[model samples]
Target: MTRHLIYLSIMAAFTACGDGGKAPVQQDTVIAATGGPDTLNRMVLIPGGSFSMGADDSTGMPDEYPKHTVRVDSFWMDEHEVTNREFAAFVAATGYVTTAEKPISKEELMASLPPGSPEPDSSMLAAGALVFTPPHHRVPLNDVSQWWSFIAGASWRHPEGPGSDIKGREDHPVTQVSYLDAQAYAQWAGKRLPTEAEWEYAARGGLSNQLYPWGSEALTTGVAKANTWNGHFPYDTTTTDGFTATAPVKSYRPNGYQLYDMAGNVWEWVSDLYDVNYYAQVGNGTANPAGPAKGYDPEDPGQQKHVIRGGSYMCSDEYCRGYRVSARMKTTPESGLANLGFRCVRSVANHGQ
Candidate 1:
């Protein structure tokens, strides 16, 4: 099962870069307001501050350990995850194509596989993004492939595949977006993806050493917090938060910094390239750390991945406590999953503010 996950990750990396018919061209037009009135209307100014960046408790993953002090300059952050409506505007204006929309190349696919790996059938090589399909019965948590399927023709427009559409869910956070897709959107919007340190700082809001964006309270405790699985993972969701999948942005209360959906709804992409040993190498009092120059994941050494924070609706204490503020996850930059999305940020200087 674990091997299957690694193979899928590698395949996604190459498949996402597959060439579609469109020729690559740069867009000179900037659609977003550059430090104009609309800037504050859409983004919040996070004050500069210092805080402990990682987890020190038992909940911390090996990569999140060796909690270190970090500092960041003030920046402007999107109020919530990027929405389908916003993404559609970018696509319509820029005529941009997302990774999942491209076709897979056999050469790229073969290179991604392990040595002597069997060539995938033509049908299996069809371009698509991974979708989370829950099982009818309880399944072992060890094998994630049981719930995740690479469905052909699945893209941001058709989130659930062929027949699905965004339609009235314009306010919902856009899914099936690869890191490259997010980067393109940011470039068009005159902003950039947040650094891992910036993301954690903003997610922490004004609080410090907290387990969640809201506080130390358990996800299931008190009133329903962020959107998360209820009953069990992979199967049987009680919908305690009134959502079984991605919820509309701002469905829950905002954090101290007035950032919405900073904990769940969907995992957000940060600018940092992932490195399992990054935290250990980070010295104390590091300011505006941009993360390691390259990504290194021992499990999938061949695949370059980036850090993704803010777990999605599928997160739960039962199987994956990814919703925790300090929790971390990584995937190939080109891998677009139904549970993944991103937001943008701008440095104060970049914003010309």
Candidate 2:
């Protein structure tokens, strides 16, 4: 089984970006006391303050270790992850092609593989994106290849591969988008992807060092505050939240900061490059810290990685408890998965003007 799985996985890798549906009315106005109109972007102002940057609890992961104090300047953040409808509008206006829509680059493919790997066949280099394909029975968690497939013709338009379409999922967070694709959309919208710090701070929702966006309680407490896998993972899901896969971006209640789907829904792209030792290098009470200069993952040193926050619908307490606010995960910028998406942020100075 291991040898068979390895052969199947050798060509597999990538992230999420979804296609179009109904477009929403972009509210481009700012809040005002009088009858003044609102803005097209829905943003919430995050006040600048100092807080613990990572996890201090046992449920935290290794990368979130050595909890340190960090402060972020005030900024405005999107209320929800970018929706399929919004991404569709950007595509229609700019005719932009996402990274996943383009052919898999040999250079990128080489970067992700083990050192001295052979050149890939032309067929494996076709334009495609990573799509989640759950196995029939329980597979060893060590081999992710059992669940992820690299399919040709898979792009933002066809999230689950060639025949899949966004259709009625207009409000669902766009999946299968690479980090570069997210950045492109953000630039066109005059916004940018949030830094890991900013993302975590905003996710805190005025709370300090809480386990989740809701508070320091395991996700088992309430009536499914966020969309996550119920029952088992990568095999059988109960869909207790009424979604077998991606749910509407606003299906859950907003955090204390008035942001929706911060805990679960999809893994959100952040601007920071991933470095295992980044926290140790960060000074106490650092302000407006961007992140490490470059990306590194010891598991795959050949691949450059960027930080992704928030958990996805596939996340479960058993396999991946990534919904915790301080939880961290890293993937190549060129990689797109079925459960990965992103939101944007704007500097305070650029809010009204």
Candidate 3:
């Protein structure tokens, strides 16, 4: 999700102490209430402590390797990704329209879409946001049309293009939103999006040198623990994890942090810029270091792209394996997709002040 520009979202269940470090649930697990059940029902208690951020060697991306010590203060995070009901309240409270819902400027269309890809054939460019359902598989990341489509009438209301509705899945993670949309919802709920380092730290669940959130084992072992592609690339999906689209948050097990669906589900947005070599400059000891203050990905330098964590259902061994704690990707601010969603954090000091 790229809002004003930059984005991310994810989930879990069961109440328990967070990764060992400091406090218990009674410490940093307070949740703010919106008008309805839409608000994230659960909150993870992240105890402030120092842990090794990123992994060592070529096992991880250049940006997530050379694991370094990083210390984060205690903070509360939404247990599950923000749902439709919750976002709806934010929209209702403030008539905030997302960039996806905004009309596509001829300039934007020409800039985002492939050249010669005929102009949008609709009443307006805002017919719908790009959804992952269209591609539904592993395709070369460079090929934009392989995964994204300008569906007509698709918005946050209809995650699976315009035909979808939040009927039985109001509790499910909301998609097709920009980072700004998620930020708006977080602000309205009195929270903020988690930073890339914070999100990975929480997802790792205090485990050192881990690959995925659960364990070194993959989601499929005799049982499907998380939602990801099972079959071939860019084609058949066995749905072994259950459902083709975004599954309800927490359908899988929780990590050491008592946080659910952190590995495979939907790719979550994070508050970090994409710096390919950010890890090489890691500082010693545990310190919360934000990525290069104002860096942009070389791939899409014209548009401000922000980092997204926790790979999506589309990730496969043959393609993207970013579901790991240190893995991440970036998207344009105005880009919207079914595979993208978001969660939030809040400053305890801001609770009263």
Candidate 4:
């Protein structure tokens, strides 16, 4: 298979459906105890308001352009990204298996590849996910493959491949989870992923037309603002934020809505099908736009992608400035990287308490 097909096949493996019966543990109780406050208490109510969405500065990518006015209805959102403890509780209560834990099927691999592409070796089709392996020396940022490796047996439980474990990092944001996995947890918790607009609105934290969730302050100024790479990209890291990877939730102050880690820690998965040109198509003063019906990425056109926001510990000014509030990134729904995770939101009308 071609290089693109190889990438697609590996990503497709991450989209496999999970299977297991619900366990005896009460879902509500389990969710309640998984870090933060109990059920409704943990969710902060964001006041409904209007804000300009997308990048308003020169740092924005093409997809973050055509800044438009968006109004979102008030909703309750988690105080922070879902943690390992919370995810573990969800798994314990539901016996759910994440996509990364599932073995790849040849049929699934073939579906993403070209019609007559040769089949990959079975040895390459193991249960695993991508891990960010920083190089000892700086490398070109253009080639992402230089730092990402598909390691077998890598999952949320083992974030850095086989030997790694969550262990004492229960409070840290759960990573290596696919969109489906996140959606599953949201559903079981009687919540749902935030729309791209709702996420940006909540991220903005009542701030209007600002660069970051905390306003237009430079990330490098003052104390460490978020868990981002403090040195050269893909190599040196000063750990100026006191973390080389995902940090424990609430390591820093929260945004205006009292939400933590909205700018960094891990890239948050939003409930929006990614379209490179979606912003151009959006009408001004759109109310609660849910995103396009289909997903498209010119780089990987055949692969359906979803929008991920907030950036991550790996984000740096030299490379990805994803920590910016209006910044946007896309990844295949099935693909889960070490820096990706999610949180949930609940609507006022459907507040299942």
Candidate 5:
């Protein structure tokens, strides 16, 4: 599609032109030109108001239960996710390497993957954060063992880890970044990560109770409306999403919010702590809802785990269903994975002055 067309889609849902009577960005090239380093110059303007935050259906977790009402303030969120070129600017400014890229100590590696859990022995063999490995190529796709591994010189610059360069992949989202890493980029960009409520509501794109961001339609239609898994699933994708791995940002159509890739492609990190029982706290509260102030999850085995929503490209109807807008999961704030990335948000009051 033409750059002009892309901008038209982006401006539809969000607007983030920055303080003062700034004009809305209505073109792709114009948006790219304004995004100085790690951010998109343009944002989707989410009109704030009250709405139900969780799903009554059992497809979601309990924390998303009770289907209580809450309010959200107007905010400006990135029209597309953060890409390699954008993240590269942050690394250059900070000399930062993702935790997965950094060599793991013998003790740390052993704790997660014991001698018998199919985990490769020797931190020397290299074990970085593993994400999705497509079922195609006659390889085990769902099992993360195939792709994610700690290889020396594997960082954002080397996305596939070692032997890889950002060259042509500059348009793809940067992977293996931790929550802290995402926050750092947000800070540098003069923005913040969207809270879980805002993230889901925005992902819904104004759909009252739709499954995915673009209504009930699934990403897999054998034609690809959004990037997602296809074929035999954890065994084979058939490249139905147009590409096995991630495609360039905005490769698909935008939602009502003029936002792209909100439901699939990669899991975007949010600022809210993961609380399975959070909605119960809403209890007819004001609109512009925020997630639980505190977070805890059995999966993390630590204190205060954070929430991550919007499933990854690895999502499958049989194995994974996180592509749904209300779908959510929890993980450590320090964890990083190649299949996971993030977007940015700012208050609407701060936008266009």
Candidate 6:
């Protein structure tokens, strides 16, 4: 993610599939709601099944190639991405401090920077995270610095920077959350992040072989099903889906599983450590695959990476089509950005189902 590059370069910054073509008659319907003890968690029961896990579509990025079959056990997933209000409740209960709220440590700085690099200025060591700042004019997309800035005091509470606050956006998906921060919230709630396989399966909403959770429909048509960039991406956006940035978590229709915001709104943090080649190594029809034991990103080999599913509002047909179900992206576990957020999942084992 470009959002993490600038932050990590200075502070040790950071960090799907399918279908046919139709929604299965039975599977497309949401699983019957169970009044389990975790019902208050507001989770949707995803009755799992086998599905292809990567992009067979040529438009997909290289990492999404070699589509493969995978099986994931049924699990309960948050109905939507974790929102500011929900995260606030977690913070109030646990007094948990997010990674973005903590200043960079000397040890972490030294490990990330090149051995010969000079010591960083004290001012750059403040507590903050990355915030998106669109350039006034068109700029080369290759250099993301033109559109991203690392700001001090830019944590989940201050998604846009020092003066910005999430005050009126309580129902919007929480942003600027690092992987550890999301994991902490999950642990506190007795939940865990979903595995990439589980995530893709859920996102499909029982629709097999479709290009999106919504089926084979083109993204450019109809009442915008998800929040994605409607114009020239980084340079411009029409906000056609009624959001220039993160929208309220359920701003659009739910997927077959009754899961909202599965295609866009924000990129979601999942539990799996990323590996471009892991799909190739796993045998077909593999059940309950947890992803590679370790993480690796060819682009940033030295940094440990985790998979982030779905796409954010910044994605557009002309620039990034990451909103696609099979698309994959990774970032440093510690990197936080205004466009990244997450939801939690709990295995069926947790409640003895």
What is the C-alpha local distance difference test score of each model?
Answer: 0.81, 0.78, 0.66, 0.82, 0.65, 0.78
lDDT string for model 1 (1-353, tens) is: 12225455433323456322234432422233123223323889999989998984787789898899999999999998988878866776567788887876777777766677766667656767778889999988876767877778888888888778787787789999888889888887889999999999999988989989988887877888899888878789989899999999999999999999988899999999999999999999999999999889988787778899999899888877788888899987778889899999998988853
Give each model's clash number.
0, 21, 17, 0, 25, 12
By lDDT, rank the candidates, best first.
4, 1, 2, 6, 3, 5
Better of 2 and 5 by TM-score: 2
How much is the lDDT of residue 340 in candidate 6? 94
Candidate 1 residue spans exceeding 4 A from truth: 1-14, 18-41
Candidate 2 vs candidate 4: the lDDT winner is 4
TM-score of 1: 0.91
Order the candidates by TM-score, highest first — what do you get?
A: 1, 4, 6, 2, 3, 5
Candidate 4 local lDDT, 284-335, one digit each (tens)? 8989999999988887787778999999998887888999999999887777
Displacement of residue 202 (Cα, Å) in model 4 is 0.7
- Give the backbone clash total of model 6: 12
Instruction: List, residue by residue over 307-347, the lDDT tens digit for candidate 3.
Output: 88888888877667767777878876455677888888765
lDDT of 2 by residue, 1-353 (tens): 11112323655553222332223332321111121112433888999998999995876878898899999999999999888777767766566777777665667565546666666767667777767899878888777787877788876778998788887776788888888888888887888999999999999999976788988777767687999888777899888888889999778889999999998889999999999889989999999889999776676665568899999998888778889899899887766778999999999998766
Candidate whose lDDT is highest? 4
lDDT per residue (tens digit) for residues 1-353 in model 5: 11111112222110111111112321211112234642343687898876666773678766567776667888889998898778766555555555545455545533443244333345343434443333335544433444333344444555565566667777888776778778878877778999887898788888787777778765665357777777666667677667787778899888999999897788888998876567666668656656677775653333466788888777777656788888877666656666788999999766654
Give all TM-scores, in the order shown.
0.91, 0.89, 0.82, 0.91, 0.79, 0.89
User: Residue 316 lDDT in model 6?
Assistant: 82
**Model 4 misses residue 66 by how many Å?**
0.4
